[model samples]
Target: MVIILESLLGSMFEALLDYSEGFILRQEVGGVG
Candidate 1:
């Protein structure tokens, strides 16, 4: 159970990072073009 929870949290954090990175990239592209 503990391992499962840890893995879930890790994935969530990774997803959040991916989302934020994409958002920043979009903003940069919009600003440039």
Candidate 2:
């Protein structure tokens, strides 16, 4: 049970990181264009 929760939290954190990075990249591209 604990292990499952840990894995779930890890994935969520990773997804959040990916989303923020993508958002920042989009902003940079928009600025350049």
Candidate 3:
């Protein structure tokens, strides 16, 4: 149970990072174009 919760949290953190990176990239591209 603890291991499953840890994995879930890890995946959520990774997803948040991915979303932030993508958002930043989009903003940069929008600024350029």
Q: After superposing candidate 1, which stretches have Cα over 4 Å from the reference?
A: 31-33
What tens-digit string does per-residue lDDT give for candidate 3 at 1-33? Answer: 999999999999999999999889989899563
Q: lDDT (0-100) at residue 31 of candidate 3?
A: 55
* Model 2 misplacement above 4 A: 31-33
Name the lDDT value of residue 29 in candidate 1: 92
What's the CA error at residue 26 for candidate 3, in Å? 0.5
Clashes of each: 0, 0, 0
The C-alpha lDDT values of all candidates are 0.93, 0.93, 0.93
TM-score for every candidate vs. truth?
A: 0.82, 0.80, 0.80
Pairs that collide, model 2: none
* Candidate 2: 10-residue stretch with minimal lDDT: 24-33
